[model samples]
Target chain A: MPDFDFHVSAFAWVPETSRGWVKCLRPRWAFEEAGFAYRTTRLGPGEGGSDGYRAWQPFGMVPAYDDGRVRLFESGAILLRIGALSDRLRGWDDAEEATIASWVFAALNTFETHTSRLTDGLPGAVEAVSRRLEALEAALGDREWLVERFSVADIAMATVLREIGETAVLRRHAGVSAYLARCLARPAFDRALQAQFADFDDSRVA
Target chain B: MPDFDFHVSAFAWVPETSRGWVKCLRPRWAFEEAGFAYRTTRLGPGEGGSDGYRAWQPFGMVPAYDDGRVRLFESGAILLRIGALSDRLRGWDDAEEATIASWVFAALNTFETHTSRLTDGLPGAVEAVSRRLEALEAALGDREWLVERFSVADIAMATVLREIGETAVLRRHAGVSAYLARCLARPAFDRALQAQFADFDDSRVA
Candidate 1:
């Protein structure tokens, strides 16, 4: 396999609690799922906010990538770039690709926003998330994946949904929960999860 | 110029205060900036939650687009698609395009989130917004735009920043404030803003 000159970034010290759930895993899972050989650099603990870090990631966020040319941040954008290279993840055509990319934004700006609020037990959070999930559930309606086949859109949306897991709000929607389960059941997600865990503590193997 | 047969959605009735500030303006401004001919559909007041609305927009958000090909929501995605078709908004090349795309996400998922809270008078909202603004300020230091030349990144970032206006947090960051001024000064933004106001009640021409 040709090593894709994709060098990404992650937090050096993600506490065990949030290690498996950081946003960096999005790119990792995308690369793993697309069978793209990529590597990552671990910034020092809490170094994500440093000036050096901010150069690549203006908001001082994680999971920026350099494909031996463009060094860009935002997992959504990175995943889209990766998706552009791999046909399966890239979707069938320009319109399909944009639709797929839209879901990634939906995950970040909608589903995840509500899910995070739900987790924090914020007011009216469940209702907000459920509304979005209801739409997603109806869209899924026994579909095996989001589009024709599993694409980068699922990688983005599932990662956000995965955070809800067997939680209260998630448990209320059987179809959505099942969809989440199916997404998590992917070997790519497992490998990505393992990789994240491995990055946390050297003793663990991905 | 030929009409592009692109149909977008927006609030049928935006109150005087937010008439021109609706999210739909992102795509409207984008289309105008790219000089693309398009039209829009107005969903009745609070009709964003309808099943028909949710079909194209899972979260039932405004600014969904159907361009005879792909139907999608998320202004970031829509802007990227529009940017892809326009050289001025698409940035210089592949790397530049992805970087511009990343900024769009930053605007939606990061900057906008902060500004929303700041508007709500949420605790520590100013500080939160300031941090991101600081990073943004650094990036735009001694520069006219986010990327080498003006691109879609500026459009996205400027729109979000425009929400804050010459307000508290923004007032403290002169450079960032000035950068936003440069973006909104564009004739396209002026036209889009005017078009949005035209969609509102006679009481507000904002």
Candidate 2:
């Protein structure tokens, strides 16, 4: 895979609590789903702030992406780029693409905002997340995916939901809990998880 | 105008504090930028929860969009769709499109999450937003827009930044402040603001 043209940047090491949860997994999962061979450019400790890296990722965040075609950062945006390149993950048409993009924002911005706060145990966060989950459950309504088909929206959503998977607040929304299970059960997710952990191990410094 | 193909939904009325800051203004501004004729589907009091409205916008938020081509929610997503539809607001090519999308997420998700908290005076929120604004100021560097040109990404970023327009935290980032000024100075933004306030005035309930 040395010749792999697509590249997604990731952290070589993260704290034990964050090892499996780094956002690089979003693009890594998308690559797996798209069956697109890609490599990870691992940034170790103290390496994220290099002027060059900041040029690629202004916030110096993980999961900056580049292919010969384009270079960009933000896991949600990286997922969209991969979606554009892969038919299986993209909307079947313009209208469907709009729906997919909507869910992407919903997952990353609308839902993640509350869920991340809940993860941090911020005061009043539970109520915010519960309200969102109720809306999500209704929106899901027996659907296995956030849209008509499994797309990058689910990838963004599943990753965000994973932040709260252990919480009693999440357990209360049976429908949403089931949806998260269906998303996480995908083979691509497993591969993405394994690859991220392996990177953490292989890139560990002495 | 009665037969305009594009429709952007807006709240018919809002409290005085929220009159000009509604999310619907995002799409309204985009429509103005594209010079596309569009009508507002005004949602009156308690109208957001109607089953049909919920179907269009799962979270019952304002600014759900419907054109003959596609119908969707999420202001960020709606802006992307408008960018796709209007040449002036889209990228020159695929690579540029990816950059625009990245900044859109950067604004809506990354920056908004922190800035919104800072606006609410959440404890420790200022520090979080300050760090992001510094990075953003560095990123803006001499650029007038987040991407190569004025696009929906700027729309998203500008609106989020407006949340903290009055804060000393924002005033400290001179580069970012200038960049935001350039975005707000656009004639489309003024039109969007006028339309939103006028709607609030006309739609007031007895």
Name model 2 segments beyond 4 Å from true: A1-4, A201-204, B1-4, B201-204
lDDT of 1 by residue, B59-163 (tens): 677889877767778888888877887866777777787789888888888787678667766667799899999888998889999888888788889888988
DockQ of 1: 0.65
Stretch of 10 with least lDDT, candidate 1 chain B? B197-206
Q: What overall lDDT, based on C-alpha atoms, would model 1 receive against the true structure?
A: 0.81
Q: How accurate is candidate 2 locally (lDDT)?
A: 0.88
lDDT tens per residue, model 2, A61-174:
888999977898898888888888887898888877888888889998899888878877888899999989999999999788987889999999999998999899999999
- Model 2, position A39, has a per-residue lDDT of 84
Could you give candidate 1's per-residue lDDT for residues A1-206 as a string of tens digits?
A: 25459788887676568778888898999888888888778877567878788888877778889888677888888888888888657788767776787888888887776676677666777888888888888877778888778888898888888878868778888888888889889999999888877776443323
* Candidate 1, pairs of clashing residues: none
